[model samples]
Target chain A: MCGIVGLHLRDPALYPRLGELLTGMLCEMSERGADSAGVAVYGDPVWSPPGHATVTVIGAVPDLPDVTVISLGETHVVHAPVPVDALVAAIRAQLPDALIAGFGEELTVLKGVGHPRELAATFGLAKAQGWQGVGHTRMATESAVTPEGAHPYAVGPDQCLVHNGSFANHATIRRHLTARGVVFDSENDTEVGARYVASALADGRDIESALKSLCAEFDGFYTLLVSNRDSFAVVRDAIACKPAVIAETDAWVAMASEYRALVGLPGIEQARIYEPEPERIYAWTR
Target chain B: MDSMTIVMDKGVNRTLHRLDAGSVTITEPNGKHSVAVGLNAPLQVSIEGHCGYYAAGMNQLADVVINGNAGVGVAENMMSGSVRVNGNASQSAGATAHGGLLVITGDAAARCGISMKGVDIVVGGSIGHMSAFMAQAGRLVVRGDAGEALGDSIYEARLYVRGKVASLGADCIAKDMRDEHHAELRSLLAKAGYDDDPADYTRYGSARQLYHFHAGNEY
Candidate 1:
């Protein structure tokens, strides 16, 4: 079980209101899953820090330095201008189990084993600025509960996603995606959708076509929500074994696992809420 | 009489949500199987709309009322209490009835009262085929036509149909309806608001012949 929420604000000025609504939705939807929570907000800055953050890890620090290497054996210092590959290699060299998932120019993702509340405190999620994104709260039914199992998983540059349901042909799909240089870090079926969609787009398939192709190939229950800096998409599986509510107004479009979360939103009374039809796609831009 | 209320969804019936307190009025609110299966309360329930499948199975102490068409097994294993249907009833109206009363205001489908033990069943319309297959006890009084195999393997149960008897059960024959039976049939008809003539019927029962299931049984 998991809860996924997405919002595409047609009105750019409602950043604060959207943030409040998004937070409330995440907390409320957390009831479906309490393993982890993360949101990728678009176009709004909680407190703009930098265009990029360099989280450096030093190997076996014999001595502590006051410089950027202020952290001990393994450190996650949100520094600027650090190379991505060098940082990943350094962290992997020290802690081979290290996983570095990044998003957008400024917003970064850091997850570990804990509840949403605890992870939020550790990741300083409240301080992360808004970018177009999807949020996830995991229940860990088929997948393990670790940082790798956490979601809003980056499928591409500045891309993240959350999903509910299992893929019937997960192993076969994973094999096909693995052959295309798509990395598989977790055993979550939702991640297979992400990898396939991301690989399709990287091969010049547009987001719409990529999503359609993914649905055509995959079978089972799913309500997938994905977002990047420019676009967001929500797809209902063929059977609709999971629940997804879509509430839309001229100003904003919101998706949540249930209507109760949306009811607490600021403009909910003005929107129309409904269940997404089977095998349907709902996407928006800017 | 206490009461019970139940809410139903479409295509779902056979539900008798617990009864508590005096006579209850159940508003169907559009659902099927709203009241059925093992009603054991000492209350009364009045369903407001159509019901589906086993409206009152194994009814013990509660009185049941269906305002619309009843699906299969309207009152299957009634042990006590009373079931009154305002509309037509489907097959197995009171199969294996042990006690209590089943009153149908309109027509009844096949197997109106099969294997009746001790309960009394009253139907206001025509009964269909294979009714009262192997009745062991109780009485079935029909105010209308009866189809073929009216009482296929009759035992000790008594049957009275107000119309033509298409057939009969093994070692079974028609008997004369006495004064006491007339009084009881009239009371049941009156309860379901029927005013049909009771004289144009025939009574059927076992001769205690095949109650032991003879090896060489014949139709």
Candidate 2:
């Protein structure tokens, strides 16, 4: 079992409170999964400055040749004036064994192996300001209880995926992706799903179609919350055993595994709240 | 018969369990699991906000009202009395319940009344897929539509759906709504405080095909 929460803001005025609200949602779900936690924040100026490429890595990579590295708790953020591909290649050459938590133009991913609340405090998540944020608390069902096994697996540029249930056919799909030369970071099932969606998105499929393809191919119960630079989407398996509730208002769109994670949101009493149906992709594009 | 208000916190269920007969109000439920659960007294509970899993589970001789939405397995394994949800209910509403009436005024998510033994569930809005799976005995009344695979492998349970049924499960077929069924449905609707016409519904039950093992049946 895992806890997944995401917030996509529509009004620019609410962006400053994005992290504060997301922290509350994430902490509320700590009871669902308390072993490890991760988060992906989009449009954070301090973490991922505009007009610069940023890559978040978790390892002992003290100094890179050209880029600036800032340490935030257990994860490290690398910023370079070069493009994303260049920075990624340079980082790969320098820290070959380092795990790239996230890499994008406007996204920064932070994850660790600890209680979600403590990790949030260590990362100073409440002070973060972003337009979109997705947080996950992991119970270590498919993988070990380490930072590497934590969720919000950002496999693609500016894309993040968090899952609440296991994938039964992940090994088969992992083999399929491996045959097509998709290197994996961990043995986690959610990584396989993230990699599949990333590959589909790379193949020019939209977020909705990519998730629909996932529903068609993957087997097992799942409630997935995926986000990119411009869109936030949610989908469930055909059976939809995993729980997911979504609430939307004019200012923002929020999703969590339970309703308690959403109680502290602004205008929540007036929000249109409902559970996402099985195998139906609900996407909100900015 | 004293009236009191209890803010939800740890060990609150124990306090509630100690109450024999009183009117208790639970505020700030905050989606906590097992709220007001396992009540055996003649008490009245009113939860002021949304609840998490198994809210009012194993209820007996209590009238519990949730003013907000209920999470998974609301009123599961209920013995007697009634549980009412003013908002939508999450998955497996009244699952494995033996008796009592469960009223969901809004839509119920997947697997409503799954494996129900003898509960009476009334859903004011639609129910999601795989509802009433392996139901041994019960009465389920859905005022709105039902999702796919309703009453799969059901046994003896009567289903009354007022609106569309996406598909019926295996061995579950539509039956003629007789006069007795209309009367029963009318009584059920009245109990659940609904005024819908009984003739607007269709009854479904097991065809008994899976009841007996057949040599030709493939695994």
Candidate 3:
């Protein structure tokens, strides 16, 4: 069992408030699973891989983009949080041929292993300031925990997804995704779903249509939270083995594993909160 | 009686204090479990909200009151006293009990009072499947309909039904509610706070013909 929280705000200047909002929700969501935490943020220019350029995301970040081979994880992050354009340029510098194609906005993904507080610190997640951030706390029933095991997993640079509950027929689904050149990283059902979704949308399918296809094809108990630059989506599998609640207002939309987490947010008193029905897909504008 | 109040939260973990004949009321904001377990004395406990499984199991004390619905096995093995549920109860409400009384105000799910010794369970609503399965002793009173295989292998315990009996267990048969039986029903109902007339119910028990079973005697 794990818990996921996704927040979308109409106000981006209020992005700094996410440090507090995500931290609070992660605390309560810790009950679902306490192993790890992670979050993905959408800023101003969405980074896209160059169509013909050689795209190689080293396991760590490195020094020079074309000549030097950076380990898959270590890229020089801007210590002082800068504006959206600078952040996007810093990201593009990593992959010389990468362009701003899909999400015409800046995005930040921070995740790591350990408890929510611990992982949040390791990745400097709560230190981040942005709007429309999604986070997850893992319990580690199906997948083993590792640096790659933390959630809000990025299927690609833009597509990130988190989930709760067992995903049945994972082996069969994994085989298909791998065949489609969607690389599998951690041995998690959610990772398979994330990769499949990103590849599908990249292959020219709308977000809703791709998600519906995944729902129709996959069998399991899951409440999935997915997001990109301009929008967010939520879908639950046929059987609701896990619980997910959403609190919405004109000001913002926040989702968590339980009702207690939504107790006192801005507009919370006037917010309409509800548990998402089993097997329904809900997508909204960012 | 003014029972002692123990405010329990995350700070209190493992090893619940037993209460014997002592009256206590619990207002658990966390909605915890094992409130009053493994007690030897006759204590009465009133839980304010929904309780997790096994509320007053293996009781040797007095009565307990659950203000809300109970999870599985409200009284697992009752040695004595009584357990009263103000709301519904889940499967195996009283399984393998030797003594005491269990009163459920609402419906009870499957397998209520399986393998009874000398206890009495009174449910005001319908019971789910496999209730009274292998009940050895005591009495089960259901005011509503019984599900499939009502008493799979019933023993000497008496079963009273106010509604339809879908099916009966092995060695069990619908019995005539004689004068002595009616008096027993009246006493129990009165004790459980039921003001309904006695004649509305029917009693079911072992034919006693299977008290010493032969393979040929079972159906």
Candidate 4:
């Protein structure tokens, strides 16, 4: 089981309160799964800057002196370590968005293995501000508990995906992706989902079609929250055994495993709240 | 006049934990999961907004009224009392519930009353597929159409539908509505606050042929 929280802001007035609101949303779901946690924040100028590229590595950085290394919002960052030649190859491999941190034009993915609340505090999420944010609290069922196993698997450029249930056919799909030369970082099932979306986007598939393809490819119960540079989307399996709730107001669009995570948002009382339909993709763009 | 009012903005666990036998008002429910779970008192819970999964689960003698939409499995495994949803409800509206009167003013989605054991469910609008599967006893009244596989693998439970049924599950068949059935249906409709005549509905029940296995039956 896992808990996922995401916010797509519509009103610029609430931008400054992004981190604080997301922090409250994330912490309210700590009871769902406390094992590990991760988050992906978009539009943070200091973390990703406007032009220069960024990447988030799992462990200590490798020896590369030309790239400047910096840390922001408690998330470790290093300037583009990929040799110009390797960067293309890395993209070809469909590297995860969480692992790379900086994706596309701007994104910052921070992940850690610990209680969600503690990790959120350590990552300084209470003060981070962004146009979009996605957080996850994990309880390992198909994989081991490690930093790499934590979620917000943003494999696509400026894209992030967090899942609440297991995929039964991930191993088979992983094999297919591997045959097509998609190298994976962890054995986690959610990573397979992330890679699937990244692969689709790499081939120029739009977010809606990419998710529809996922509904046709992967099998199992799942409620997935996916976000990119311009859009936030949600989907569920055919049976929709997993739980998910979505609320949208003129100011923002929010989703979580349960409704408690959404109580902190502004205008929640007036928001249009509903559960996403099974096998249907619901996407909102900034 | 009032027992206590609990606000459920933070989470459902703490608010439901403090409920007692009195009039309780829940404000800003915001679709929180498991609201008013496992209540065993003669309490009245009025949820001011939409609520998430398992609202009033395992309830006994509690009257739960959701002012907005209700998520999945509302009144799950409820033993007694009533659960009323003013808006639409998601899947498994009264899954495995033992006894209670669950009324949904709007439509109820898939698997409504699945595995129901002696619970009475009244839906003002349509109900989705596989409803009342393995229902041991009780009545299900739908004012609108029923989806595919209605009452699949059903047991002694009674089903009444005022509109079309897309399909019926194995061993479930339509039965003639007698005077007693009309009276019972009238009472159920009255309890659910619908003024429609019970004679407009059709009754369905298990065929009883599936009770014993045949030598070459495909089943």
Q: For candidate 3, lDDT tens digit of each residue in B135-160?
A: 88898888888876787778778888
Which regions of candidate 1 deviate over 4 angstroms? A17-19, A43-50, A53-96, A121-131, B1-219
- Against the true structure, whose TM-score is highest? 2
Per prediction, fnat is 0.00, 0.88, 0.00, 0.62
Q: Which is the winner by DockQ between candidate 1 and candidate 3?
A: 3
Q: For residues A1-286, could you state the per-residue lDDT of candidate 4 as single tens digits?
A: 7999999999988877888999999998898889988888887666666655666665554445455556543456554544433542454354334355335556778887888888888878888777999999998898999877889887767789999999999999999999999988789999999999999998999999999999999999899998888899999987776878888999999999887789889898888877776788999987
- For lDDT, the strongest prediction is 2
Candidates sorted on TM-score, descending = 2, 4, 3, 1
Better of 1 and 4 by lDDT: 4
TM-score of each: 0.53, 0.98, 0.55, 0.87
TM-score of 4: 0.87
Write out the backbone clash pairs for model 4: A56-A100, A97-A154, A97-A155
Q: Report interface Cα RMSD per prediction.
A: 14.6, 0.7, 6.9, 2.3
The DockQ scores of all candidates, in the order shown, are 0.02, 0.86, 0.07, 0.55
iRMSD (Å), candidate 2: 0.7
Tens digits of lDDT, candidate 1, A1-286 = 7888777777656655655666666766776789766666554343224544344222233332221433311324333344544444555565665455443444444444556665555545454335343567888776787656777677566567788877788889999878867778789787787888778777887777888887899988788887766787888775454767677887788887755556565666557654565566777887
Candidates sorted by DockQ, descending order? Answer: 2, 4, 3, 1
- Candidate 1 Cα lDDT to native: 0.67
The native-contact fraction of candidate 4 is 0.62
The DockQ of predicted model 3 stands at 0.07
Superposed model 2: Cα runs more than 4 Å off: B215-219
Sorted into a CAPRI-style docking class, model 1 comes out as incorrect
Better of 3 and 4 by lDDT: 4
